[model samples]
Target: MKIFRMKNCLLGSAFLLLLLLQFSCKSTYELGRKRAHGISDNRLYNQIVDSSLSYKSLWVKRFSAHYESNGKSQNVKGSIKILKDSIIMVQINAPTGILEVARIYITPDSVKIIDRLKKEYLTSDFFFLSEKLNMNVDFYTLQSILTNSIFQLRDLYERQRPFIRNFKGKAIGDKYVFLSDKAAKVERKLRKDKYSRLYRFNYQRFEIDPSLMKITDVIVREFGEEREMVLKYRDFVKLEEQKFPSELVFKVKDSIQSLSCKLKYNKLEIDEDLKFPFKVSNKFKRIYPD
Candidate 1:
C-alpha cells in the first residue's frame, strides 16, 4: 500500500510540473505583447516627431552599404556635415581606399547631387541620397538620422492613409504587426505607380519595437529575383541630447550579401562654417557649351 501511494505521489508531481511550464510560456508571450503595445500607440509617435525637428545642425559618420548576388559586398564610409536650410557635404571613402565626394545643395527650387568620383552629377526638383542606395528611405528617415530622433509612427501611417481602407494593429509576441483593410488593393495600386519597381520586392514580415520606436526586422521574400533586405539597429546612445543608432546591419536576400556599419559622432557644432558645393555650382554656366 505504501508503494502504491508513492507512485501516485510521483504522478501528481509530474502533472504539476507540466502545468507550471505551460503557464510560464504563456506569461512570457503576454509580457512581450504588452511591451510592444505600449510603444505602438499614438502618444509615442508625437514625441518622436517633436524630437526630430528641433535640431539645427549635425555632424556624424555614416556607412553606406550594398550587396550583390555573387556574395560581393560594397561599403562607403563617410562623414556628413549638415547646415540647416543651406548645405550638406558628404565625404565618403570607397572600399578601395579612394575618396569620393558628394555635395548636395538643398534649396526651395531644386536639389543637386555632385559626384566627384565620376565627375558627373544629377539634378532634380526633389531628390534624396536614399535613391542612390536603392533603399526605401524618405524625408522622415533623413530627419531621424540627422537629429537622432525617433520616427513618428503616426506620420508613416498618415502617409498611407489614403490607400488604407482599414487599419488593424496588434502586438504578437515581441513584435507589433499592422494590417491594412485593403492590403491587396494597396499592392495593386503600388504596382501601377511609378514607384512600383521599388515595391516589387517582398518582405517576410514587418515589425517595430514600440519601446525603442525603431524598426526591428524586415524579412525579405522572393530574395534572388528581387533582392530582399533587412535593417537592424543596436547600440543606441544619446548624442547632443538625441538618441541614435550606433550600429546598423543590413542583410540581403538569401543572406548572399551582408554589411555592418558602425557610426560615430564628433565635433558637432551648429551653424558653423559649412558649404554646399552643389548648390554653388548650379549658378555657374556650363563650361562645355551645348
Candidate 2:
C-alpha cells in the first residue's frame, strides 16, 4: 500500500511539472508576439495609414549627428526650425561648436545652403537637388522625412482640405497603398485581375509602428538604380500625446557618392515660439554645385 501511494505521488508531481513547463512556454511566446506586432486588428491596420499622416506641429528640434560618406566620417550637431508648410530652417555645426558650418533654408519654391567654412552659398530649386542625386525629392518629401510623417501625398493630405493630387490608399502589411491620380485610374480598370494591382501605386512601401501608427522606416527606390535612400527611426518617445523618434538613421546612396547619417535627439520642443537665425554675410561667396 505504501509503495502504491508513493507511485501515485510521483505521477502527480510529474504531471504538475509538465503543466508548468507548458504554461511557461506559452507565456514566452505571447510576450514575443506582442513585442513584435503590437496590438493589432483589422480596423487598427486599416486606420494606421491615416493616423500616421495626421501628426502636425511647429517647433525647434535638435540632435547630435553622426555622418559618414564612403569611408569618411564626422560627428556633428544639428537643429531644425519648422514652420509648417511655410519654411524649414536647418543648422549644422561641427564638433567644435565654435562656428556653425552649414545652414540650409528650404521654402516651397527653393532651397538655399550656406557653407560657412567655404564662405559660399548654393541657392537652387528642388529640381537641382533631384537632378544632382538622380532622386525624386522636393520640399514636402524632405519635410516628411524629418518629421517622421508619411511620404506619400494620399496619407499626408487632410480629408477636409482639397488634396493636391488624387490618391487612393489601402493597407498592405506595414505599408499603405498610395495610388497616384494616374495610378488610381489604372487600378479601377485592373481590379478584375486576380493578381494585385498594387504595382500601380505611386509610392513605395513605408514601414510604421503598428500600435502608434508612426512612421518607423522608409526606403526610396522609385528613381531606379541611380539612387536610393533608406531611413529608420527608433527609440520612440511620447510627447504632447504624439510619438516622436529619439533616434533616426538614414543612408543615401547615389552613383557618385553615398552618405550615411545617424541622428540622436537630445532635445525636442513642440508648439513653442521658435526663432530662425539665417543669413549669409556679404563676405560669403556664392558657389553652386550641380
Candidate 3:
C-alpha cells in the first residue's frame, strides 16, 4: 500500500524515464568544440528550425531502457504512442510474458495511470502533479522531451511560431548553445500558474549539435530550487531523412527526491494513425497522492 502511494504512481506518470542514469556532466557540457564555417545566428537558427522532425503522429513500436535509483538498477521494456499536441500513451511491460506492468494515458489537461502490480489507478491533472513535484510542468513539456524538440519558456512548446528563435544562439566551440530569456541575461516577464503556484520559466538552457542541428540537451531549474532537470538526447537514427533519437537519458531532482534513466528506442514510425487503449479493471482500486 505504501509503495503504490508515491513512487510507482509517479513512474506511471512518465517518470518511466527516471529509470537509468548512465549520465556524465562532462559529456553534457564539453562537446563540439571544433570550429565550423562562420554563419549568422539567424542563418544558424533557421537551419536548426527548418531541420526539426516534422510529424503529425509518432509510434514507438517497442523500447528498451535501464533505470536506477537508490543504488538499485533494473532493465525494462515498453511502448509509447503520441498524437501531436493531443495525447500520449505509455505501457511498461513485465520482464517475462511481456505483460503490462503499467499503462498511462496523458492528455493536454490530465493524466491517468493504471498500475497492474498494485492493481490501483490514479486520476489527476497537471496542476496537481505540478504541485506534487514542485516544478513548472505541463503536457507540452513532456511531449517535447519525448520527441527531442525545442520549446520556449514563455509560450511553452514551439508550434508554428518557432518560440526558440527568440533565444540567443551561437556556436560555442563545437556545440550551439541556446539560453532562455533569463539564461541569456535578458529580462523577461515570467508568469505564475494559478494551480501549481510556481512561477514559469526558471533558468533554462539548451545545447545543440552543430552537425545535426538538433537540440541534444535541455536543462531547467526553478526559481529557488538547487537541483535541475537535465535531459540529453543522442544516437540519432534517420527515418525518411528525418532524424530521431535512438537513445534518450535524463535526470531530474528536487529537494527530497530524484530520478534518472537511460532509454533506447527499438522501433519507430512517424505520421501514423494510432489508437490508445486504457481500461481499469474492477479489481483495481483508485488511489490518491499522500
Candidate 4:
C-alpha cells in the first residue's frame, strides 16, 4: 500500500512540473512580444532610420567583388555607380582578367542585363525581378541593397513623404534594435478541412549601435508559397565616417532548387569617375523563363 501511494505521489509531481514548464514558456514568449511596446522615444528611432538612409554617396562608389553561386564559384571584379534616384549601373568582370562578363543597368522603370559569356541580353520591367525574388524589387531596392543602405516600401526617389513611421524598437543590454512592422499574413486551405497560414516577413531589419549611430547588421527576408529569399550583411567598414559592409551573403530556396551567393569586397573606392559600358552582340541568345 505504501509503494502504491508513493508511485501516485511521483506521478502527481511530474504532472505539476510539466505545468510549470508550460507556464514558463508562455511567459517568456509574452515578454518578448512586449519588449518593444514600451519604446516611447520617437526621436531616437528616427535618428536610427535616418542614419541608414543618409548614406547616399555624393559622387560615385566602386568595389572589386568575389562572387560565388550554385555550386560554382568565380573570382570576379564588380563596380556600383548610383546617381541618386536616377540610375544605378553594376558591372562584373571575367576571371580572364581583361574580359567583361556581365553588366546591369537599373533605372526607375526598367532593368537590363547584358551577358557576354552567353552573348545574350535581358530587358524587363521591375515586375520580372519582383516575381523572380518573390518580393518587391525596384530600382531603389537594388541600390539600397547593393550600397548597404536603408530601404522602404517605395523608392526614396519616388516618394516625398516618409514611410518608416511604424518601426518597433527596444534596448537590450548595450544595443538598440529596430524591426519593421509585421506584414499581413495569408491563409489558405491546404486539405479539405485543414487550413494553413503564412506570414509576410519584414523586407529588412536594422540593428544599430546607439552611441556610434552605426548599423551592425541588416537582415532582409521575404516568404512566398514555397520559396523564400534571405540576405544578411556583416563585417562593416568605416568609410568617410559612414559604415558599409565588406561581406554579403544571399540565399534563395524554392521547391525545385536552392541558390546562394557570397560577395566579398577586395577594393572599395569612393568618388571616382567610373565608366558604365555594356554592349551585347546580335549573335548571342537571350534567356527567358520556360
List model 2 lDDT by residue over 1-290, tens digit each: 11111122221221111100000011111111112333333444355545543333454344555666667666665566777676777666566654666776768787677767667777878665445333556667666666666655333223423332343444555443334345444445447662244332333445545456666666554332445567776766555555566666777676687766666655556656667677789998776553
Q: Cα lDDT for residue 37, model 1?
A: 48
In Å, residue 277's CA in model 3 sits off its true spot by 1.3
User: 135-173 in candidate 4: lDDT tens per residue?
Assistant: 466766666666655555442123334545645566775
- Displacement of residue 223 (Cα, Å) in model 2 is 6.8
Indicate the residue-level lDDT of 7 in model 1. Answer: 23
Which digits, one per residue and each the tens of the lDDT, describe model 3 over residues 9-125? Answer: 336234654222111121222235455556676787678768777888878777777776655667777778888899888787777627888877888898788878778998888
How does model 3 fare in lDDT?
0.65
The C-alpha stretches of model 4 lying farther than 4 A from their native spots are 1-41, 53-72, 132-134, 153-162, 183-195, 199-204, 220-227, 279-290
- Worst 10 contiguous positions by lDDT, candidate 4: 18-27
lDDT per model, in order?
0.40, 0.52, 0.65, 0.48
Score candidate 1 by TM-score against the native. 0.51
State which candidate has the highest TM-score: 3
Cα lDDT for residue 203, model 2?
A: 34
Model 3 residue 90 lDDT score: 77
Q: What TM-score goes with each of the models? A: 0.51, 0.65, 0.78, 0.65
Candidate 2 vs 3: which has more lDDT = 3
Residue 230's lDDT within candidate 2 is 72
Residue 122 displacement (Å), model 3: 1.6
